[model samples]
Target: MSLAHPAHTPDMINIMIVGDSISHGSSGDWTWRYRFWKHLREHGSNIDLVGPKDTLDNIRTAEVGDDDATYADPEFDPDHDAQWGRPYLTEKDEIEAKVREHEPDYLLVLLGINDLFWYGVEPPQFEANLREFVACARRANPGLTIVLGTVLPCRKAVDDPDFGARVDACNNRLRAVAEDLDTPSSPLAVAETAAEFIATEHTWDGTHPNPNGELRIAAAFADALADRFGIGARYPRPYPDVPPVALDAKASID
Candidate 1:
């Protein structure tokens, strides 16, 4: 479907999503981000994608249960295949440096699962850190829009029952923070995927999602931006039935 507003050309919008492994496409076939990108391209839009090259400073261990532990000790357990290091941009300085360089038009930040998995940071610290990330990015480019991606629901590890709940809490706090960041007349807005994505069975593992999940995520963010900023949509709103020319299950995704 075409955008509802006056049609925009390819250069009208440029998006850059930043975060941990999720932003890096470790979830599924990186479908979420790619799907969003594909929609824009099909509609004759140009998008500039920016993210890290590798899995830097992401959660390295799987929690068997909610009570498994608070933060994995920063030590490599070769037998268990667990690493002792930290996730990338664990500090604000690193993120600030990167934003100054890229200066993207729209910045999508998806993080904190590693913090939950590793350091067991509570809602307060997580919000504070996320706020810092957002503030710094906005400071670097005043007109830049920000979309905060949420942690996907995870199947309980044999050891963790509260893993999913903790993620919920994180999302809740993020929503509050995003709202607080907005003014009645401000241009900054929030995009949420917690509801749209978690129910789908497209996850690569029980935790990370596959390509379909990614597409949903991208579409959700694009829709959010269109609603809030009046930016033309990348995907056709009021989506219709699949076309015969559409990609097959495997080929479409690839």
Candidate 2:
């Protein structure tokens, strides 16, 4: 039931987004994952965004509730494996269980910022953790397609010179890891987000992306999916600052 083809397909592809604050997003803000969802819907792709948790970091907890604080978008399935301030090593076991439960066709991973910045995990250790994380997912689902995202640049890199080098080291190792893990049944690719998401314009506080940044991030994933797996349409940038006029909106008869 994989829609990893070009032609008009009716099958639905299950996708799971896994990361930290960058993926979890805020209460009012739309994450890159959300933008990707919109892109898939617009392109007439049958897909389900799957995850165990459905709560934004700044908005709500993962607990069930009836109030507005409980949901980011009640209509949309806000399920994801994003936990604020937590590294992949901290939640590798939980992520494995999630992969087994959801059985997603694709796993979009955008992590490592916290691991390098907060935890001060060196490049070697970070790569090891990343390798273990991918292994966990593959063990859960042998046919799963894993797309790893490069660690985005941050303003902190200016203050901490070693931070940038560490990020680069991790990304270099990540590319190698992808090459090592790719197979015919299960493929691995890297979504280049670091270059697209500049710390100045794309991010609000040198870390989290604003709306424009979100779109760019989404475009990166979309491009990767379309180019590498042929799963979805590629989304171009220059996203509108204001909402477009509704085609069906009615005007009073004059």
Candidate 3:
């Protein structure tokens, strides 16, 4: 039974993560999806991950078992639909097919950085593209629950003010889109990643997720699902380097 709201949460909850390079991970990285999946298996049950694609970007079949492979747990089910260099416009065309094929109960989406970097899509178009993504997925499965990650800030924000402003505007519009599209049959939650996600500390190269970043992102989506739709138990783990604790002001002087 659904926990609080009494919505249509499936007994065997099928999940798919759709996004760009950050979620797709590189050859030797433990993706946030891995962290999210681990949380699900630990705190929830009857969970089945579904997607057409599995395996990190550019990772070989031979590297799965290597001791130094760097992935936190390479053995976790890697089913997902994310890819490197894919923007929202690209995903807009492909999401419906993947959703129809996987028939997932929930979709966790993290995108927009690539769009700002590569696609020249401003806030208005980004919102439109996101709206279309939700529409297309719903067309495939009307009852699909979705959790959208707000456009997380990155090191780009530090390098370029214009880019940072775009990120902020995109996030603002994303909330509007989520609010506009969310329904009881297809509940939508806007996960709070942008506010607390620190790009430099969390990412290895200021864009991709490091170990701590994975934990933070996973907790955001996991908590959103549990709190909003009662899909999984809350991921109560604390994020590392977050709140960016500072040393005592007078310690150095002392």
C-alpha root-mean-square deviation, candidate 2? 7.7
Tens-place lDDT per residue, model 3, 53-167, is 7766543333322122334456677777777778888898889999998888899999989899988899999988998989999999999999999877889986899999999
lDDT scores in order: 0.54, 0.76, 0.77
Q: Where does candidate 2 have its weakest 10-residue lDDT segment? A: 244-253
Candidate 1 lDDT over 108-186, as tens digits, reads: 6666677787788777787888788777776677666777766656544223667766777888888888888865432
Off by over 4 Å in 1: 1-12, 26-30, 51-91, 157-161, 183-186, 234-254
lDDT of 2 by residue, 169-237 (tens): 899998999999899888999998786777877776688777788888888888899998787788865
Error of 2 at 56 (Å): 1.1
TM-score versus the correct structure, for each prediction: 0.68, 0.84, 0.84
Q: Number of backbone collisions per candidate, in order?
A: 22, 0, 0
Query: After superposing candidate 3, which stretches have Cα over 4 Å from the reference?
Result: 1-10, 59-70, 240-254
Report how far off residue 115 is in candidate 1 (Å).
Answer: 1.5
What TM-score does prediction 3 earn? Answer: 0.84
The alpha-carbon deviation from the true structure for residue 227 of candidate 3, after best TM-score superposition, in angstroms, is 0.7
**Model 2: what TM-score?**
0.84
